[model samples]
Target: MKIVVSGQMLKYQVRNSSTSRSSPSSYGTASPSSSSSNGSQHDVTLLTTSRSNSLVSLNSLDSSGPEGDWGVLKVYTSDIRQCTDYKTIRVSTKTTARNVIEMVLTKFKLTCRDPNLFELWMELTTKAEGKPVKTILRLENDAKPLELQRCHPAGMSRFLLHMNATGTLVRVYDHNICAASNYKSLMLSSLTNCEEAIDLILAQNRKSREESANYGLFLTTPEAEAQIPPEVSIVSVYVLSQPQHKIVIRPLDSL
Candidate 1:
């Protein structure tokens, strides 16, 4: 999707190339590579911002309003850059993070049967090296946005709505030589394919891609465990995975 913010055009898509760099205000760097075993890639941007140049009326919600039963909350999606594309909603003290998500989806005309498929996060901005750095914290379902806002200083935080990986929670471990206790939980978006997941996993583990070319993803379920191909979608893997499913990464020699 494309949107105009601050007289500049911003395009949002599930990116695997470095050609498209996010604005300085964005949380993280864009995807680094486009190499995927899967011939096709899904169109899903993991994180994006939208707030400026909004078509929605801003009559009722005001950011400067005092703490009360009702307040305004700005919600950003993954289609545009920071504070450029957003939907403003009037929230109450009774409003939960899940409630905000439903409002965002409905206002944005997005269709999703499961509200749990999405999550609301708090974006804390701090200055580092003369640039803004963002820290994201997932909000609990019962957390109140309006009330929470009062706890923080002004302009220090904002809310962002993101899609949660619908797949089973997979714990990735090193080869058998490593202790079983050493594992990293991989909970990426369902839109992430196996290839992107692999890159993301390697990045998280701080392993060099050039050195890990022989590594593969293995999915383990209560019924069985098997090595997954790079072409597989995370959604497809989820279908085959049970609640106890996990993804184990190992070199080809260790398999």
Candidate 2:
């Protein structure tokens, strides 16, 4: 249980290499070969930036102001890229990313697979809480709880759990239970020891997936008494999409 979340500081730099290369902002882009690549026909071209970065705080999820009634997301499962068992889920913006992907395949019991060949890649961002994270909608399995809370993302607690086409990346866990004086906050700008800060605070969450309180990523600490200048390096996080956000790859009916 190693959780150290202080302020923030990594000065933005993520590319441990998921094949690197990703661009085209307004937070949307999927085709990182996340397992054999089959669905393509999702097109969106909007970087014209004049004013568009607060879809009610990107559909709100405790950005500390609007979103409420459960909105926490951040899951990671890596096979070759090498990150593991990191979860922070708290559904209900009316739920249904296929019931949160069958609640992450029944919180990893495999829920007997075939949840329509699995696909819930809804990663998009640009409410500029410091942009960088990106992964467009790849949800299509009749997903629409108002299009999954309008592809929500206000800040912290991200998502990803691909094991579909055997690209490997599998390691999901989220029983959603949070507590301990409103927990969830581990945003260190730079930490060194304690087993790499307990795998970056359990790789950003999951000491039994609990979020009945703290409202996520400690809402960006940064009070530091007085000596300012130390806020950057949240590894990478972004979410704000609705260029109609849609990407689907469903065609594996053959076992």
Candidate 3:
């Protein structure tokens, strides 16, 4: 007699034969009618099946559905404005005036400008019977004035206040000398003495540190330095009439 088997049936038969031992008692010969009936049936049982494979196929179709565009496009918002306080402690004598100025400007988010103002002065003082004696001495009067200039780089504005000297008293002046300018007004009378100036700068630094500790600066790293934007550059930085002050201006991008 002739027997016909489908591919699936043949595969199943081969797999079962290889993986399982069939005992004579377990295998009974089918009746002639039953064998003929099974041969007439077209349905074939799968040898291997899994619900997980079917689920994977369904998930793939869902991933590429109509909403797929949402996944492809990303939306971003501008970074929030950062609140910067201050950092670093700089001591300026005659020689280090420029260095101190640069350090302070960088710390305080100030930029350098051309024709920049840079001046250095000392508040000389001597102790009297019960009080103190004080006087102001301009470094320029005693020696060659330090080089104060504005630096205008592509996309950034900066002012450079430099003096190559030993420890001496120094004060910064900027283009906006009047009390109206935020930067000028804030630094004026606010700092009357060396100790006061140092204390003020340190206070700002401490405030910054405290803000960072509280996560008020909205920055991932508080100690990270600020980079000047490329669009703006320094315009000018020069010493104003003020004896120990400097001023500078730059493009808005410098901020």
Which candidate has the highest TM-score of all? 1
- In order, the Cα lDDT scores of the candidates are 0.58, 0.34, 0.25
Ten residues in sequence with the least summed lDDT for candidate 3: 71-80
Q: TM-score of each candidate?
A: 0.39, 0.21, 0.20
Give the per-residue lDDT digits (tens) of candidate 2, residues 92-180: 55454567667766676654344444555544543223223433445444443333444554542144544444221112112222233
Report the error of model 1 at residue 213, Å: 51
Tens-digit lDDT track of model 1 for 1-255: 212233222223333332232332343445422233453322222334432122112223444435437779887775332445677999986677878987887676542223556778776554434334444556777667776676568887787776643545555665442443477665555555666666656655556656556777788766788888887765567666677887777777875
Q: State the TM-score for model 2.
A: 0.21
Against the true structure, candidate 3 reaches a TM-score of: 0.20
Q: Which residue pairs of candidate 1 clash?
A: 50-85, 50-86, 51-84, 51-85, 51-86, 52-84, 52-85
For candidate 3, give the lDDT of residue 60. Answer: 32
- Root-mean-square deviation per candidate: 18.4, 20.8, 37.4
Please give the TM-score that candidate 1 achieves against the real structure: 0.39
